[model samples]
Structure formats: structure tokens, C-alpha cells
Target: MIEILNPAKLAQARVTGALVADILQALKSRATVGTNLLDIDRWTQTMIADAGAESCYVDYAPSFGSGPFGHYVCTAVNDAVLHGLPYDYALADGDLLTLDLAVSQGGVAADSAISFVVGESPAPESLALIDATQRALRAGIAAAGPGARTGDLSYAIGSVLSEAGYPINTEFGGHGIGSTMHQDPHISNTGRPGRGYKLRPGLLLALEPWVMEDTDELVTDADGWTLRSATGCRTAHSEHTIAITEDGAEILTLPTQDR
Candidate 1:
């Protein structure tokens, strides 16, 4: 379903987005060498509870994933990219970690993701992968505004990832997000401009750019949730929940200074 938030709903979305961003940032800070993936999930749960919010993932039963995610956050490491279910493994130095989170507060929801290197001595390739996704995310956000086509954002994002020499997988991409975690108007990572859904004020979209180092193919882990690169190469993902407005797109997931 596609939801166009009213002013009050949009305000609530901003709050939920900030909370999601803060929780992700906190998890990143706590994820170090030897830190267990399950610990990250626990931290996310605590943060969400303390904020009096609900986790969009805990009871999530999307068809592509195993029923009921049963976790508070997605902890993707190394080759893992999307739908990364938290496991018993501990993070090692130089591991690339991606945390994707979504939460609801005051009846509104927001989603965001961030990929970063854990511990010291991050590989140059890992750093490059993260940078490419980040740049692509920025480009996608820049292309979103009133009357803009979803394809415009996709083209802008794809150009950056392609120029960075990374292949994008359209199997999973961005989408409309609001009262629920996911919604309509699927936003692909790459597409032709001036095509697809037209943007309108009050529309919320989660634009994510993710890429594997060498292949666009993905393999599901035995756990049935974690998606990894076919070649076992490193990967990265970046995302933000944006609201299309008269002026432009507002990044609701940006970290607040005080938080």
C-alpha cells in the first residue's frame, strides 16, 4: 500500500526516523571485534523498548524471508547483505557490518540502514564498497522531490554505483514506507529517467543502494534469511527514509546532534 502522510503523521515519522537512526548508530558503536551478533539484536530491542516504540521486524513474516524475523535488527557482515538474520558468530576485525532497522512510534514508521567496517584494519576493498553505496544513496536522495519520477532517483543512484564498478541487484531495492515498514511504489536501484511513479508531497520512500564487489547474484544462507554475495566477496548497503516535499526531499533518518 502507498501512504501519503498528513502533516501530523509526517511529524511522527520524523520522530520515528530519528529514533531508528540513533539506535543504529548506537549499535555500530557497540559492535567491535569479538562482539556477538546476537548482542546487537539485544541492544536494538532495549533501545526500542526504552523509546516506547515497536519493532517492525520482530513479527515480520515477509514471503522472501523465513516467517517472523524474530529479531530486533539485521546484522549483515562481510559477504552478507540484505535480510541478514542475527546469528551466534562474533565479529572479527576488518569485517564489514551492515545494520538495517525500522521502528514505529506514534503510529508512524521509518526505516534506514548503514554499512561500516568493524574494528581496525578495514580492507581497502571493503572501504571502497561502503563508499560506493553511500555515494549512491546520496545521489538517489538528491534526485527525489515533488513531481520527480522514481526512475530519476534510480538512474541517479545507478550511475554512481556503475561508475564505481559495482553491479546492482534489482531483486531487492527501496520502496514506499509509512504506517507500515514496507509499501508500494518499488524503487529500483537502476532505471531510465522520466519513467515510473511520480513523486508527490508527503510521500515517504526508503532509498537503499547496495552492491556486491564482483557479482549481482545472491545466495541465501542456510538460515533462510541472510542473503550473501554469490562469490563470497564483500558488500555494502546504505539507506535513508526521505519525505518528498514542496522544497525538496527531507532526510528524516539523519542523526540528530543532541542524540
Candidate 2:
């Protein structure tokens, strides 16, 4: 469903967005070598409960997933990309970690993700992969505004990933988010411009651009949730929840310190 937030709803959305951003940032800071993936999930639950927020992922059972994903956050490391279910594994130095989170606060939901390297090691390829996704996300956001079409955002995002020599995958991408976690107006990572749903004021969209280093194909892990690169190459993902306004697109998931 395509949900247009009223003034009050938009206010609630802003609050939700802030909470999600803060939680992600906190998790990123806590992620280090030897940190267990399950620990990250537990930490997320604590923070969400403390904030009186609800997790969109917990109890979430979709057709593609195994069943009610009993987790608070998605912790994808290295080859893992989307729908990464937290497991019993400790992080290691130079591991590329992607944390995707969504939460509902004040009846509104916000979603966001971040890819970063864990520990002090910095692998050039890993950094480049993360940078590409971030750049694509920014380009997609920049192309969003009132009257803009979803294709415009996709085109902008695809250009960046293609130029960076990464293949595009449309199997899963961004979507409309509001009272619920996922909504209508599917936003693909690559598409033709001037097509698809047109943007309007008060519309909220989660634009995510993710890519695998050498392949666009994905394979589900044995867990039946985590999506990994078909070629086992490193991957990265970046996302943000944005609101279309009269002036332009307002990024609601930006860090509080950045506001």
C-alpha cells in the first residue's frame, strides 16, 4: 500500500527515523572483532525496548524467509547482503558488516542500513564496495522529490553502481514504509528514468542500493533467510528513509549529530 503521511503522521515518522538511525549508529559502534552476531541482536532488543519501540523484523514471516525471523536486527558479514539473520558467529578484523534495522515508534516505522568494516583492518576492495553503495544511495536520494518518478531514483542509483563496475540486482530493493515495515511502490535499484510511480508530498520511501563485488546473482543461505552473493564475493548495502516535501526530499534517517 502507498501511504501518504499527514502532518501529525509525518512528525511520528521523523521520530521513528531518528530512533532507527540512533540504534544503527550505536550498534555500529559496538560492533568489533570477537563480537558475536547474536550479541548484536540482543543489544538491539534492549535499546528498542528501552525506547518503547517495536521491532519490524521480529516475528516477521515472509514467503522468502523460513518463518517468523526471531531476531531484532540483521547482521550480514562479508558475503552476506540482505535479510541476514543473526547467527552464532564472532566478528573478525576487516570483516565487512552490514546492519539493517527497522523499528516502529509512535505508530510509524522507519528503516535504514549501513555497511562498514569491523576492527582496525581496512581492505581496499571492501572499502570500495561500501563506498559504491553509499554513493548510489546518495544519488538515489538526490533524484527524489515531489513529482519525481521511482524510475528516476533507480536510474540515478544504477548509474553509480554500474560506473563502479558492479552488477545490479532487482530481486530486492527499497519500498514504501509507514505504519508497517514494508509497503507498496517497489523501488528497484536499476531502471529506466521517467517511469513508475510518481512522487508526491508526504510520501515516504526507503531507498536502498546494494551490490555484490562481482555478481548480481544471489543465493539463500542454509538458514533460509540470509542472502549472499552467488559468487561469494564481498558485498555492501546502504539505505535511508526519505520524505518528499515541497522543497525537496528530506532524509529522515540521517544521524542526529548531522542534523
> Candidates' lDDT values, in order?
0.94, 0.95
Taking the tens digit of each residue's C-alpha lDDT, what string does model 2 give over 1-259?
8999999999888889999999999999999999999999999999999999999999999998997999999999999999999999999999999999999999999999999999999799999999999999999999999999999999999999999999999999999999998998999999999999999999999999999999999999999999999999999999999999987899999888878
Query: Total clashes, candidate 1?
Result: 0
Error of 1 at 226 (Å): 0.5
C-alpha positional error of residue 251 in candidate 2 after TM-score superposition, expressed in Å: 0.5
Worst 10 residues of 1 by lDDT: 250-259
| Residue-by-residue lDDT tens digits, candidate 1, 1-259 | 8899999999998999999999998888899999999999999999999999999999999899877999999999999999999999999999999999999999989999999999998999999999999999999999999999999999999999999999889999999999898998999999999999999999999999999999999999988899999999999999999999998999999888643
TM-score of each: 0.99, 0.99
- Total backbone clashes of model 2? 0
Top TM-score prediction, candidate number? 2
Question: In candidate 2, what residue range of length 10 has the lowest lDDT sum?
Answer: 250-259
